[model samples]
Structure formats: C-alpha cells, structure tokens
Target: MLGHEERYDVLKRSLAREARGFTLIELAITLTVMTVLILMVVPSFTGWLNNSKVRSVAEALQNGLRAAQAEAIRRSHQTAFVLTSATPAPNTVASTSGSGSNWYIQVLPVYVGETLDPNPMVQSGSFGNLAPNVKVTASPATASLVCFNSMGRLVANSDATTSTNFGTTCTAPTGNITYDVTLTGATHPLRVLVGLGGQVRMCDTTRVLSTSAPDGCP
Candidate 1:
C-alpha cells in the first residue's frame, strides 16, 4: 500500500543493511577457530613428515646393501658397501669422503684379477648428501664397512667376528649376526638390519621383535 518513492527508499535501506560485513567480534571468533585448527594439524603433519624422511633413508640404505649383494653374486666378485661421509658438490659423484659430511654409500669391487686391486672400487650409488637432516647410524659402530664375497657370503669384520679379506677364504661368522642401521628423525627412527645370511630388512624398533608377530623386527 506504500507509494512508489517510499517503496524505493525502503528497498535501498534493506539493500544497505544486507551489504554490511562482519563485525570485529565475528572476525575475531573466526580467526581464533582457524588458528586452533591449524595448530592441531601442524604437529601431526610434522611428525608424519619426519617419519617419512626416516623411512626413506632406511629403505635407501637397505636397497644399497641388497644391490651390493646382488652385484657380488652377479659379477662373481667380492663387493663392499661402505658408509662414508659425503663429498662436496660438482665432485659429488667422486667416491671420496671427508670427516665432516653426512653419511653416504660407496660400493667397491673388493678384488679383481685374483688380487685385491690397489684401488679396488667402482662407484655404485650415493645417499645422505641429499638428505642432510636425516642421520644414518650403525648400532655396532664397526659396521660402517660390510663386504660380500663371490659366494654371496657376508665377510666378517675383525672386531665383531672372524676377519677375512678379499681373494681369501670367507668364513661365515657364528650365530645370526645383525648390523642395525638406524635412521633417526625428530619423532621416530627406523632400523634397517643387514644379516650375515645376506638378508636386508627394515624393522620398527619400538616394538618387540619375537612376540609382536609380523609387526616386529626380524
């Protein structure tokens, strides 16, 4: 029942009311909720990232060991997988190590021509330089060097078990010898074990090995 001009004025006021934005209180509440959500998600995401990094390094180390074992069998020559420090860039591929760099893999043909080559080494693969934050460490400490002969048998370290060299008889060490390469991060660690039987496996050290069935370390 209103006139046209009054109706137009009412419509303008309604539109103006509808166009108003949120108040400071409403914005503050929304920001608080978003902040809480982000805070909750960030820690879990960080933990998952750390766990993934550690797992990747562990798998890489395990793969390096397996590759060396396979190469020893395939070439019918003694091969060694050594954990050494990373070389600097541009010379990254060079199989040299320094005392300060992170862990890296150097695969060497331990012997050739029925004698230990003066520089019996061929660069197989490298790690650690790319993953500086992750730490690759050994349990026995002396496991930094491990070798497999032409027979695919693990060469024993002199400190832990029987000692033998390339072009010499490889004696199997007594019992089930295990060298644990642990990849540690901010939250968790992954353990990769190399056995005398030429087996490489990854295990979760947080759980019991024997009692936890398939979920435990081997």
Candidate 2:
C-alpha cells in the first residue's frame, strides 16, 4: 500500500538497521566472557595432555615387555628387555634402575660361552624416547636386564655368563617377586610391574590405594 516516497523511507530504515553492528560495550562484554571461559578450560586441557603423554609411554613399555615374553616363548630363546641409558658407565652392567627416556626389548640367542649373543633379533625391536616432560624411574633395586628363559620365565641377572656390565642389582626372591618401572608426569605417575611369573601389569598411581578402588596396584 506504500507510495514511492514511503517505500523509499522504509527501505532506508531497513538498510540502516541492517548496517548497525555491536556497540563497544557489547563487544567488550562478549570478549570478557570468552576470556573467562578460555581461562577456565586451558588448565584442565593442559593437565589432560600431560597425563596422556605419560600414559602413552607407560602403555608402550608394557606392550613391549609383553611382546618380548611372547617372543621368548614362541622361539624358545632368551629375550631381554633392557633400559637404554644416555650415558652408559664403562665396564658396568646396564641398570634399568636409573631414569631414562628410552628402552628396548631385544631378542637374543641362547648363551654359549660366557654370554648370550650380542646381536638382538630385528623383529622384537626397541621402543622410544618418552614425552619431553615425562621421565622414567625404576625401583631402586631394579636390574638393568629383565630376561626370559626358554620356558618364558622371568629372570634377572641369574646367569653367571652374562657380562658384568649388566648391573647386578636384583636377586630372584624366594617367592613371587615383582619389579617396578614408573613413568612420571607433572601430576601423576604410572607403574609397570614385571613379575617373576612372566606377568606384566600397568597400574595407575593416581587411583586411591584401597580395596574400593579395583584398579589400585597389587
């Protein structure tokens, strides 16, 4: 029903409304809300990222150890899981007890003279350097070499033929015994337990250590 002049006025008002943008105060409020939301989320995200990195390293080591055990059983040969050190001491046995970023599960042939084969099988292989901020810590009494016998039994430095360079820290306990390898992050630590029965288990250190928590370390 509008005439030409009236239609022109209505179009101008519509365009003017369409051209309007958020005011300075509205933009400031929106920015403030977004900043607060980001601040609240960033810390939790950082913590989750750090925990994930540590867990990844722990799980990798666990899988490597299990694979080594399986290989020893299948091939009926000895396989060793050795911790790689950055600065290995001369004429001293390798000790997994110290902190390091890398480790290996090496499959070697049977012992001949005074030592097992120096070369490891290519199939078993070595596994990596942990996350930048993560670290590995083994039990104070941990042996550098964890080996499996022909029957897939866990043995640590039991053979006299092994090179003295492999540190002699652990003596097989009379009963069921376990050694711990821990992966530590900024907030939590995870433990990989290797038992004399050739069992490897991953445990969460952050979980409550009670019967109520089924996942608590044994």
Candidate 3:
C-alpha cells in the first residue's frame, strides 16, 4: 500500500539503524587499537622532551664557552667562563629537580668589557635544568671547583677527582671527572658523565670524552 518513494525511504532508514549498532568484538578491537597507539606514543613523547632539554642545555654551555674563547682572542685578554652548580654544597644533582640543578655560566667579574666595574659587563647565562629525576654526583675531579681560565682553557680544582692531558676527554684521574653527573631515577646517566675540563665526555666515570680540537665549544 505504500508509494515507491515512501518504501524506499523506509528501507534506507532501516539500514541506517542497523548500521549504527556494532558488535562487542568490533568495539573491543577498535579500543585495543587505540590503546596500542596511545602506549606507543606516550613514551616516545616523554623521551623526546627529555633529550631536547639536555641537548639545549649542553649547546648553551658550548656557545658560552665559544664566546669566551673568542672574546679572549679579540681583546688579547684572557676571558674566563665562571662555573657553578645551582645548588650549594652537598648539592647533589639527584635530590634537586632537573629544573633546579642546571649549571650557570657567566663571564668572570674580574674581566671588564669596556666597562669600569667588574660586573658592569657581566651577564649570567643559564641552562634550563636536568630531567627533574636526573642528578649529578661529583667524583673527585669536579667537586670543589670548575673554571675556564684566561688562557681559554679549563681549570679543575676538585680535590677528589683529577684530569690528565691525554689529548682528549678525561682518561684518568689525570682525566676522570671528580663529579659524575648521572641520571638518578633512570639507568641512562651512568653511561655518561661530564667534567669541568670543558670536555663533554661520556663514560663510566673512567674514560672521558676527548677534549681536544672538538672542544672549541663546550
């Protein structure tokens, strides 16, 4: 008794209603796929954020060092990069948040840059911080002191660790970093450590990175 158009409309609506319902298995499969995607994405995002932070901080230090070196050469005067940890003594890079344990680099107040007072030309450069979970444990070489002298070279005054001139990164006490800044919460930092020798080396608190020519920066 229905007209052709009315019947066609009824059939279309019936199909639409049927299509709106999905089986439990199909729904579960879709959810599972989404869960897998989320799991894969979250960790990668986290790692990316951490690595970017570290790299940025490292590059900043390198830039500062390069600037200091260039300034020394330009003025024919020794320019130094004064170094210090953000925290005080017993300042373990581990206990403090990464946002707190970053290093500070600044021109030594002693050298004047066309200025009268020591600090007139001085400006402090800062790095954002380690992963809040990461910490730096000083060995013996980098404990009490870290400085880039006027000769545009590194100076280590830590009583604990010592460094040697092996033509590269710290090799022994003559080369080892007294303070080992390792990642605390995780297992990665132990694989690498930085020293005050101006050498950004990676090792097991023993063999350090080469501080030779490549060290013109950090």
**Candidate No. with top lDDT:** 2
Return the clash pairs for model 2, or none.
92-165, 93-165, 93-166, 93-167, 94-166, 96-144
**Better candidate by lDDT, 2 or 3:** 2
The sequence of per-residue lDDT tens digits that candidate 3 reaches over residues 59-136 is 554455466555544554433333344432221211222223444333332322233233322334554445344443
lDDT of 2 by residue, 1-218 (tens): 99999999999999999999999999999999999999999988877877777778777777877877887888777776666654343333444534555555555535435344444532332335443356666554444456776677776444434454343423553443333333333466677777668777887766765789766676
Flag clash pairs in model 1: none
Give lDDT per model, in order. 0.57, 0.61, 0.42
Q: Clash totals for all models, in order? A: 0, 6, 30
Q: State the displacement of the C-alpha of residue 66, model 3, in Å, after optimal TM-score superposition.
A: 2.8
Question: lDDT of candidate 3 vs native?
Answer: 0.42
lDDT accuracy of residue 20 in candidate 2 = 98
Ranking by TM-score: 2, 1, 3
TM-score of 3: 0.52
List the lowest-lDDT window of 10 residues for candidate 2.
176-185
| Residues 1-218 of candidate 1: C-alpha lDDT, one tens digit per residue | 99999999999999999998899999999999999999999989878877777777677777877877887888776666656564423223323221112333223434332444344344444554435566665544445556676676788523222122222222445434343333344465667776767777887766667764554675
Query: Whose TM-score is greatest here?
Result: 2
